[model samples]
Target chain A: MTHPKRVQLLVGSPRGKRSTSTAVGSYVLNLLKQKGLEPLASLWIGHILKSPEKIDEFLKAVEAADMIILAAPLYDDCQPYIVIKAMELLAAHQREQSTTQKRHDGKLFSVIVNCAFPEEHHPETVLRIYRRFAKDMGFLWGGSLAIRAGEALQGRQGKTLDDIGSMAKKVKEALVRMADSLSKGSPSADETLSVIPESFSHGPLSFLGSFFIWLNNRGWAKQAKKRGEDVNARPYME
Target chain B: MKALILNGSLEHQTHLAAIQEILEDELSKAGWECESLILHRLKVGTCIGCFKCWDTTPGICFQDDQGREINKKAIHSNLLVFLTPLTWGGYSSELKKAIERMLGLLHPDFIKIKDSYRHRKRYDHYPSVLGIAVGREKKDSEEEEIFKTLIKRHSLNWHTPKQKAEVFLDKDDDEKIRESIKKIVVEMGVRK
Candidate 1:
């Protein structure tokens, strides 16, 4: 009997387990496990960036996996520098292995990217980057899922996905479908996934959504006030 | 007009430095003051995804590293030229790290700009951005497309009304690159 396909989940957020990336990634992992495709290893790219020595271990895990899921938060409209650095290393390793071992040509790769912006399309640019990176690395591109306003999926700090009650029923179903697609070695038909409905994310309702986001800034303003700092201070100005 | 050119090339230092010198000379001849930062020489830590710059300190990064000084320079400049080698069809990690640390330049509040939600400008003025990407060799059509799209997206997020980008192979003519830089500076309203 063929053993279950080995899968590895790489969390690429700098915030580690406390980030929205983790929330979405954890949900996918749970679904994958339920489908009997348990991940062989789960690694954080941020920790590897801090300790270069850990990269070898990451590479070993990658070599052993039949599928890899890259879950990350968009930074400045693209993949975070840490994620890029890790990709660079992986590409270099593949180059080195091309002479001695079989290339990683058929391994499946997919992405789950989240952003602070409420619009689902906010992560589109980074998703494009992922597509390019996958092609350059010779991996089979299984497609991606972009989550907008992912931070709104509320739960305890490190255990956001454990409490799925905060997520809308439709969103939960969409995520399960995405995970199902991954298990079957195909891309998810669902393009954009979000807690906010499409109607609320665009057109006139989008104005109200922007207003709510702006209103959310009041928390930052209150913190700035408590710190006795001017919220509008131009500290970098000459 | 004051300009800041950040060099983010790792292997071709001599070639990148030559390009920088030519651009600086042309801009100076055109009566524009120029400053440059070699990013690999500085100590810049990766952004840890903390929003303290937006909330706690308000426009100040928590880390007091070279990135802080670079932010100050970027704010005061009229044009920000990013010189980088295309790493995976995007800017090198060295350059991206510096850009990530400059998030303090934007406010946490969201604003609708042309039907999309983006961060409000923390300062009244933002410098026009130009990305000059150097490839080790001739890039295929796909790499070129990805590079251009990434720069455009980056420019939009920086709130620059006019976004400019130029890609050059390592063996491309230095004179042509200098001419391109001069054209952008002139178009940005700098006069000799």
Candidate 2:
């Protein structure tokens, strides 16, 4: 019998465990496990940035994996800088390994990118970045899923997939389908998936969603006030 | 108008220093004040992606590094130029690190523009943006297309009306590159 593919999930959010990226990554990992693929490892790239030892370990994991899934939150219109830094390190490792006897090749790569913006299309640039990165790294592009209004689907304080509530049904179904395809040694279609119901993406409900975001801003302002910081401070202005 | 140029080239790319000198000379000659920052030399750390800049501190990053000062310069400038070598069809990691810290320039509030959600500007104005990338020996059209598209998308998020991107081969004529930058700066309305 052929061995099950070894998959590694790298969480690229700086928020680490508390990030929505982690919640989504965990959901995917669980689905992959349910599909009978052996999960080689799951790691938080953010934590790896601080320690050289962790980075080395991350490099080792990448070398051993047959499939790699990168889940991250979009920052400043692209992958977070920490994620880019990790890619740089990975590129360096690839270069070093190329000089040796063993050549790295043909690892399947996919991305799960989420952003605070309500429109799933907001992270298209980031998804494109991932596709290009995979090509440059010699990985087979497995596809990507971009989630919009990601914070609304999972709480900021590390909510599990089970705690995702009503949306859990659609999310789970989608992941299962994706896992099934991957387990068959082929990728699911390239597409964006949102945890938000279709009704929430358009019409009156979309307007309501905007209002909630505005309310969230008010909470941020209150927190700023409590911290004795002005919400409108422009320290850089001349 | 005051312009800030971030040189994101890693050390050992001596051509970038020459590129910086030419850019500053031309911009100054065009009657624009210019500041160029060599990012790798600065002690700016990578953004940890904490939302403290938006929530707790409100436009202030907690990291207490050169990034804070760079953020200040970025918001105050009338024009911002990103100069870097393309890495995987995107800005270098050094430049991305500096750009990531710029989240403090936007408020945490979400606002819809052109039917898409984007962060509301924290300040009244943001600088126009220009991207100048030095390509590797042979041109990769796919990489160039990705770079231009990414910059245009970034311009939308920053709400900058004046956005331009230009890529030059490493072996391209120095005079031509300088002329190209001068044309962009002039068109951006930085008057003498």
Instruction: Identify the CAPRI category of the predicted complex in candidate 2.
Output: medium
DockQ of each: 0.74, 0.71
- The residue pairs found clashing in candidate 1 are none
Model 1 residue A98 CA deviation in Å: 3.5
Question: Given candidate 2, what's the lDDT at residue A130?
Answer: 83
Worst 10-residue lDDT window for candidate 1 chain A reads: A153-162
Which candidate has the highest lDDT of all?
A: 2
Look at candidate 2 and tell me the lDDT of residue B7. Answer: 97
Query: Alpha carbon lDDT of residue B161, candidate 1?
Result: 59
Q: Which ten residues in a row have the lowest lDDT in candidate 2 chain B?
A: B10-19
TM-scores, chain B, all models:
0.93, 0.96
Q: lDDT tens digits, residues A107-159, model 1? A: 88888877767665667777777888888777878667777777666421565
Q: Taking the tens digit of each residue's C-alpha lDDT, what string does model 2 give over A39-90? A: 9768999888889999999999988888888989988778887798899889
